[model samples]
Target: MPRWHPAILLALASLQLACTLLLLASEQGGRARRFLAALFTSEEDGPFDYSHPVDVYTNLSAGLESMGGKSMRDPVFLSPCPVVSPLLVGPISVQLSGPVNLSIISRRNPWVLLGGRHSPPRCRARHSCAVVIPHRNRELHLALLLYHLHPILQRQQLHYAIYIIQQAGNQTFNRAKLMNVGFKEAMRDEEWDCIFFHDVDLIPENDRNLYVCADGPKHMAAAMDKFGYKVLLAGMKISRPSIRLGRYKMIKHKHDAGNAANPNRFTMLAQTRRIWRLEGMNTLNYRRLSREQLPLYTNITVDIGPSEKAPARRLHG
Candidate 1:
């Protein structure tokens, strides 16, 4: 051995002593105390990349050193090796406070975050409602509805999300089935108190009508512009004012597109019973027309199908 071997041994012992003293000082109640205790309890450890001899090989070593009162007294605890930052995770509230960014989970890590948070929907809330439209060859109608109805909904500020459930098929538009799918998907995936089993083509001209079925199953379209806005039926309005119609647009129907007998629509000409009552107007007075009744109505069905030039003539202003 070389003559300096004894000095090297002494230096190593001094370094160990310094590390011990430094770790003893960090016994205070905090992250240091917790980490130090955990270190003493663990048996195995992982390999680390240390820059210098003073740099601790493990968090346990660093923690013990941190407890020590004097950093210089114990170089190992005083000099910390960098550690990786752990993920900061928690659930987020989606009450529609403002704009939000939506990101899909990656294929590699598709484990849902608090997945399937939807609850069994109830008929409670009136304003914070959800409206659904099952789509097909109604592209033109969907655009019109979004252009006009979205602003109306935003104005209402109803904790709402507009869902356009497009059927993935090549057959005729399965409006009813699409609605059913939308209802299931929306309710199963989110916390919507109610829904609007809405139609794509039936775009309500007046935002006042808005597609909400809060009261009994409401037929929004009573006198649509399609039939020249003629009183095909009258006094057709939501039963319980603007706030109450059907719970979640519960007025669902079979997906038949026969124009003549399609009871699902809001013609009001024959199916006046389904047409919701507004301001307690009787069937007789409902058939009667008045200019003042426009605003009080909580629901107005849009004329989705091809229409006569009546509405155009009326809007000459």
Candidate 2:
């Protein structure tokens, strides 16, 4: 091989010198310092002294406390509603319930025990929430949903009430219209800070997922067990006070004939989005009745569903 060029050699020497200076500077602090210290320093130069009668027991105890126990800075735990913390657990399986099981649950947790339209007295919840369920011929599913949801909501320390807006008649199910009606009706009864449009088939698995609202619209059912713990856009839409990540079990059911491969599904969704942007909750032309003490389970029949008399084109409007 030909002799190496003198200029190249000088450049290489300069690079080495620069690298040495960088390594020296890296020893000052931060991650680079730690890495360089680990790489270059010997065991003798390390901070720990293995020979100096190491208080292994004391150190181990401290380490354990740091890892497993809460510190003084930690917030006080509220009964039924534990202090909110970052969610570390993943999606879990949930056992489904029938009407009989629900009736048993209802007996055990009567309107008085269930707090009716309010939360437990001991729970100083942060937000007053409304869980609106737009329903039609899904009583069994509704019962199951109520059985599981109340406990989770209570544990989350949310002052929440559940409303079941059932659609009457054999007309095509208008989910969006029912949702709008639920919002209006729930608001009429109580000054809910957060409104959750919940589907009757979905049940939350973890209580750590707080029911409190956020700054914007929140999609609660991100990771669902039905979709192999994948993020989904189904179930529960939060307005104003939105929400974040939460897992739920979506009970599978037979698709309605009206919803079977309905080509207008996307169009309806798009129209709703547009209408929400334009009018929001004010678009509906219903008179707000005076506030009433809504019971634990109250059914208000409204002409909110799609009308069979009206033309099919005006259904979305």
Candidate 3:
């Protein structure tokens, strides 16, 4: 029997290992190719110009650990976010005529929860507001307003949710009645500090217009471009004369279907004091067709019955 030389044996062993690796690489396909490429490639050959050795495994482990640590710790937020939110970038341009993507808005504000609810992550909001929009057949207007409003609400650093109270039938749209329904529904969801009756066709122009109800009741809509910046009561009309807090730019639009101005609206208005207590939220009878907690808002469709239905007397008082 002949004895093999040690150096020759070493060389043969190395060749066998090399053959094994080649076989494994061939069997494993892309994964093996990437592993081999990474194993042989120098840091200098990579797309990134690293000045120092980067321990990728260590970095990845550290990142995972850091995320885990963050998950364990409770997030501490400041209460009553600064009056002038640092997030505000005032007077953003609005596009009226265009396709607005609700999904994109949802992605942009990741903190917003299901049913279009958001609270500032950095601070506890001064006030929690429920924004109620009376809607019918104004899909474009609704989409456009929501596209513009979500970012504004985020910037304001206030806790808020958008509720779209849509009338179900082809009857004359009752804006005030829907608003009353919205108020009732909104309260059912949360003990909100205040409710803002928002019109679907209005898009706010500035982020400085905070949605917080600070003092007593406030009338937010003071001026509009549609009405030559005049005080239009039909939509968005009030605030301190000096401050531009609650101003909104009414989207240029005509009356929507089923939403034509009621000829007797003034006549109804004149009888407001007479029917104020009985016919508001309590006396109304409505059937809810659908209520969806959508990604961007809480949508509620209701059959408000015929416009001429006799008002039910208030159960209370």
Candidate 4:
């Protein structure tokens, strides 16, 4: 066998080490390339030549958009997780913990549905959903609902918006009317593919409960903690844009002030029922409210009862 010179053996080892480092640097993309370039080349060598295989691979792998096949822009990639799927999980325990601080949540979820709108950053969503919430007085409940909802909606990867159609005055908290108004307004604002009539007090316990609308109106809160883990049709209704529900929460409180249990509630319910039966969603006369026209209520409360009630009347054909 031929004996190798010491200098030749040392050179071979150095070359092997250099090749290994280059391999690692390629995997690390631009940062490692820049570091290696800086270490080996002087300022006189000018800026690092990024028109190399490593940089190209980095840009392509990151899903960056190339401007006219020239400069590269930030990536706009699709989410790794599937956007839509069948809900298979059972009910789970949900701890309200305490009132959700909107300020903190706002900072944390800057991309959450804001001013009643959000589009997914990934690929185009399967549906464009509009969440319509009737309002009178329920700040805490609303905050908590948004806190839990944003995360759930995000997990579902939906293209949705949140519309709080607040009542102008304290006249019987016309839930059905407000919901009608919300649907009309949301439709008027943009072409919504689906609409969800959601109660602010009902926080979903499981993320697996899909928020997408179905072929017909879908009752979401099939199993609610408030109803002893029983299905309640009163909480959420998922429907196509052509069909909508007049659903609202009966918030619990020390007094029946501005609640469904108020003295005028029965009368209001009767009137709303008639309107719904007669004109359907058209009974809601849409009116725009200025900021000053809207009333703000604080210290809202709620409670969930048993599910022994009869089935909800079908509001759509």
Candidate 5:
């Protein structure tokens, strides 16, 4: 609904092309070299440290590989589908999906260690959240997200954390990788709870965007005052008529960049940076983006995925 929408889309597309055109300075070699060089090449440096979580996650971790190895299924029209796990954590089998029913479980200390009503509790909250964000030069966005989202959590009585994994070295903005980062980060802090890899620019207008992580990574950006997107109805929506898709429309917008992380149509912003190696130091630390230029990946609650009652949000860069 703003005059700048078209311009923003065009500019983003052009920048993406520019970044894509670059040869990535040797892609994987650059990341490995930079990280490794940070050690032995330091001349005074000692053996490499795999203890750093970021390093472990990005470099020598089996988590990404596990996810990559598994083929993700897009939920067709139905109820929330089950995500199969090889008993990595939690119960042998877990069924998590949809907007969730918090009434079945206690809001206070939802985690088992937090002291729930009972084992296999009444299911107060199905509690699972995922934040998929499209990112570029957003350190400020991340800082502000930490600033605002933390308080919002306190007020709304939601359980979540701030995940800010920028595009590796020099790569394109990968929204999904950011989501994966949030997944990993949130897991690091809170287990059993869902993860939300949200955009730094968008903040939820209502507490209804419950911090409970919803079921299976909810999108809080269903609507934001900063951008021109809106949900027609309050509950389960059919279509987001007011929201205009931004540069995020392309599935490869970010993910297709450099990371060979088996990107789905899930808006490859983060992994794209890793696999394709888009923007690096020059773009990541660049000061060109103001609060105005950065994009907000909005939310949409509609008759999507498996269940009509299940609320979901659509995102755009």
Candidate 6:
């Protein structure tokens, strides 16, 4: 056996240490990347070279709850962004902490505009998306959702904006009605290519779960941690292929007070075909109370009126 020189042994040990640090940094996200960058500064190969400031809207506070800003329509990129985004950070470990400060999040994710709008700077996005969330009294849930979701969306390289349609005055919290209102309002603002009716508490654990719409209306929350990695649709059976796609991590919380299970669900299910035409988006009636354009999202508070007048009358006949 040949004896190795001291210099060769020392070099081999240093190479092994460097390799180990790189593996660790890949899993640990930004903090570990910063440390790695400090240790391994170079002219052409560092994380800082790839890191660029996200392009956000400059004058977002110029108009009336202005969801349709001139900035969104402005010509930015020539080439279409890749379907499989290169900027993805893979699996995310979400934080279920208390109310998060928006200012801190804004600094962290500079790509998102005043109305939670983000568009990829390097390439034209394939899907122009609007995420409508029905909210009532779940302020903490909303804050946490925004905290995790913004970064994920940015990494996905999507042209997306988040809309929070808040219900005004307590009236048993009609989630479906709020969603109808959200759809109507979002469409009125812009002709979005796709829209996602997202639940406020469903935080995605992976950035691979794209928010873009499919050929049909897609159910996003297929596998959730709350249901032991089962489909969130409860009794409705799903295909194995789809179940593999829509995995999410939900924030743990007790049942909300106002959002009790509908007693008329069974009755309504039976008469769904009979009243299907008259019931849905056509019968949506809500009075807009206020609109506020915040740094992260657009909050539109609305009075959905009494439940008796909810399914008032059909548009035709």
lDDT of each: 0.37, 0.55, 0.68, 0.51, 0.32, 0.68
Position 74, candidate 5: lDDT: 23
Q: Ten residues in a row with the worst lDDT in model 6?
A: 56-65
**What lDDT does model 1 reach?**
0.37
lDDT per residue as tens, model 6, 44-110? 2222211332222122222112333334444463477787776654445666763387787676665
lDDT (10s digit) by residue, model 5, range 1-317: 65668889999999986664453445665765565445544321223222321110111123323322223322232233123222111101111221122232222222212211111111122334334344545444443333333333333322233334444444434444344443443454447465444555554332223444332323444433232112222233332211211101111123334433432334433233233333322223222111111112122111111101211234669
Residue-wise lDDT of candidate 4 within 1-317, one digit each (tens)?
99999999999999998976887668665776666656775432333222221211112212212111112111234433344422222232333554467676565454553363554454445667878787666767777677656655654656677777676544456565566667766787679887777787786654455677676666666533222111122334433211011112234444336554445544544455334345536443444644221111111111111211222455876
Model 4 residue 48 lDDT score = 28
Candidate 2 wrong stretches, greater than 4 Å = 1-93, 98-102, 110-116, 224-245, 258-263, 267-280, 285-295, 305-317
The TM-scores, one per candidate, come to 0.33, 0.57, 0.66, 0.53, 0.30, 0.68
Clashes of each: 21, 1, 4, 2, 46, 0
Cα distance off (Å), candidate 4, residue 147: 0.6
Residue pairs clashing, model 2: 218-243
For model 5, the local distance difference test gives 0.32
Candidate achieving higher TM-score, 2 or 3: 3
Better of 2 and 4 by lDDT: 2
Error of 1 at 261 (Å): 10
Better of 1 and 2 by lDDT: 2
Model 3 CA RMSD to the hidden true structure, in angstroms: 24.1
Model 1 residue 288 distance off true place after TM-score fit, in angstroms: 47
The model with the greater lDDT, 2 or 5, is 2
TM-score of predicted structure 2: 0.57
Return the candidate ranking by TM-score, descending.
Answer: 6, 3, 2, 4, 1, 5
